[model samples]
Target: MTDLKRLGLHDLHLSLGGKMVPFAGYEMPVQYAAGVMKEHLHTRAAAGLFDVSHMGQVILRPKGDMASLCAAFEAMMPVDVAGLAQGRQRYGLFTNETGGILDDLMFANRGDHLFVVVNAACKEADVAHMQAHLSAVAEVQPVTDRALLALQGPLAEAALSGLVPQVAVMRFMDVAVVDTVFGALWISRSGYTGEDGFEISVPDGGALGLAQALLARDGVMPIGLGARDSLRLEAGLCLYGHDIDTGTSPVEAGLNWAIQKVRRTGGARAGSFPGDARILAELADGPERQRVALRPDGRAPMREGTAIFAPDGTPVGSVTSGGFGPSVEAPIAMGYVATAYATPGTPLEAEVRGKRLPLTVSTLPFHPTTYKR
Candidate 1:
């Protein structure tokens, strides 16, 4: 096998009994000796530290003014970039001409510039896309000197505040640069898990130290990819290549809320983005299919790629993300199905293995979110 890239906390991960696995071109921990189940439950009850350095960090500085930069960015996607207030972060997507999503991302307006985080597998292409499109109005700089860490769960604030008391005042989606002994931490009070947490970007030199310190705190344990996947799946958040991709439109993926009113038809800045015609049309009308939450009938989890069928055995959709939610203690899944069958409590069948299993369309986030809004 070819060598895989390693995170800055590679050694620390091994020392913590992390079982490393290849993921998104990196040798990341799938779970520690505590196992995926314990880690998942711990994260929901207390805090779990995750090493996510494989994801990309980028800085976009305006060549002219912040307004120009935001305008240039808004052209690439249907999001209202210019309206994002300072010190706050918002979820965004990059779309192709057909309104299919290229990649989903998070961008924070950090005063004069924008700080963005993209999926690990799409970072290179995302950065290139930004450079090719926004080069005339903004300087797109990829950050390579920082390692990102996510401290997640209910006790996340207490664990993080132990080191930096300033974090205690931050609300959900709040971003700030706080001085720490390790370095200046660029932190955001956000996470993919349906829990209160923070994502911290620390310089490479201080990554291991900060991770170690966080682990040293009571109720904080090292979490890995296995639990991370389950956590996000339970949260009903779409996984880029799986639940969403270049073939999926935001509206079909249940992400219309991410597309603000200003970008919709009849709004002030409507229809300039790629695929705005189809996207806006879908908004006005409705998508042929829609992403929905699923509750499997039995203990078995209907994993990704599992085909969904109507009660009459007609093919309807396919499962994108699925697994047993530790907190919910039940099998949960998210997938796209015919719009008519996407209603909550609607009966559906998933072909797991060969036999069809019963399932129901349920409300999103099988587990409720506890974001500190």
Candidate 2:
């Protein structure tokens, strides 16, 4: 049996009758006693709190020059790191030599330090890669003592206003150092779900108390991995290992906006990252395959690993993530397919349980996002 690692909120989850499951090496709650459907509806109607402490949090500081550190980091990602303003965060991908994604990460400029959040499963490899390539002028420190909590939904602000009033004013992608009843922490107006929310990074010891305080509110409920997956899928957000991997580039993942034009144009920092040639080529001519959203005709959920077929019934790709979106009232999925069949409104079929279900290519974020900004 594999030893399951527990987060700071493990006891809280168990107390709430959480259905624990092993995920990304952690014993995480897949759903609460209220069930996935109730948790999903709660998040959409009000707020759902998630314990994301299993994710890796790292702090990067420049040994001497911040600009040089930014440049060094930019060489590994396609995002415009140098242009990131203080207290702002951007989603980025760490690409390998062939333009394949190592992991998708969030980079937040915290004035004197840079805060990086990576996938729980890929954290070790990501940190090693950073340490191996970062110049002597930069120091990479892992913040294992911290815990991350995401409070997502329309009522997120209302739930948090009593604790941190400034969080209500912060726009999407904005970060603020707030002095809460617990202690000093970094609260970012962001989340995985396509809703207004905040990601709080706090001292590990204080996480449980904070989570309890949040859940004590009227609109807040404890959510789990199952609902988190469903919410991100409904929002059209990519899951690190599923929607993208070492074999997929940002271009093919429908994440071209993450790459800046200045980085594409050769200059001081242009074409410095690994697989720049292939990435630039794809940027110009488009990728052979592209990630797309799909809507199945029936109520049955199309799950990951389900085969996608062309009009002739030949395999083209496979579903990466799928489920019934409570907010959308239909089954939604995301997958990679040949570029020719990736257009919106293209007719396709997903083979589920030896049965081909009629499907069609559709625009992502199956539901409209309600971001504060």
Candidate 3:
């Protein structure tokens, strides 16, 4: 087998006794000596720091026409890119020609440039796609030397307030460039753990120091990939290769809020993205399948790829992401089922280990979000 790639924090992780596992081609900690259950609870009650440096960070410089560049990006994405205010970030999706999602991403306008964060596994292909389509109008630079860290949980504010007070004042989805003891960094009021937190992009060499600083706080703990997945799932956030992919559309994936009505109606710039036809069609006439949250009865956890069947034993869909939610104190899952079976309160059965577990289709965000704003 090929050796797994390591991130800048590999040594730090190993020293901390992180349980390393292969994730998106990188050897990362799926949990630590504290265990997944403890790590999961720690993030909920305190703060958890995650090393997300493996994700791609790119900068887009619009040379001649910034408006045109923004429009070009909007054409490839479902978000209202042109309407984004400076220092604000928006979640978006790259749709295929058939209206399926290529990937979900986060975009932020940093003063004179545009910054984007993409899934680690899809970064290369995403960059290639952007370069091939945007080279004529913009300069796309991949900033691989940068490291990203997520400080999440209720205590996150207290942990970061001393270093960057401005971060405490910012609302969710807001981004700011701040100078800290570590150095100048980009701090965004964002995170995947469904808690109030910040995602900081720092210089490669300084990442470890910043992580150490956060870990020194009273409630701060170094979290691993296992807890990160469970936290995001409890928050109803989509996982790239699972909850969303090239086969799902932004609308079908329960991400319609990301698409502004103005963009859908072709108000200012019109439909310029790849799957405009299908996307607009879905906008008018709903999608064939829709992503929904599932609550499984009993203690057994339903995992990804578990077949979901109608009450009569007919296969309708399958689980995309699932596990025990530490916060909710129950098993939670997400998946796409036929539109007819997507409504909240619908009853379904998940086949696990040859036994049919009763489940109910429910609204997403199993736990209440604690974003600053």
Candidate that would win on lDDT? 1
Q: How far out, in Å, is residue 143 in model 1?
A: 0.5
RMSD vs true structure, all candidates: 0.8, 1.3, 1.3
Please, what is the whole-model Cα lDDT of each candidate in the order they appear? 0.95, 0.90, 0.89
- Lowest lDDT sum, 10 consecutive residues, model 1, at 1-10
Model 1: which residue pairs collide? none
Candidate 3 matches the true fold with a TM-score of: 0.97
- Measured with C-alpha atoms, the lDDT of residue 58 in candidate 2 is 86
Best by TM-score: 1
lDDT of 2: 0.90
RMSD of 1: 0.8
- Candidate 2 lDDT, 350-371, residue by residue in tens: 8888898899999988987898
lDDT of 1 by residue, 222-242 (tens): 999999999999889999999
What local lDDT does model 1 show for residue 300?
Answer: 94
TM-score of 1: 0.99
- Report how far residue 38 has shifted in candidate 1, in Å: 0.6
User: Using Cα atoms with residue i matched to residue i, what is each candidate's TM-score against the true structure?
Assistant: 0.99, 0.97, 0.97
Off by over 4 Å in 2: 266-268
- In model 2, which residue pairs have backbone atoms overlapping below 3 Å? none
Error of 1 at 228 (Å): 0.5
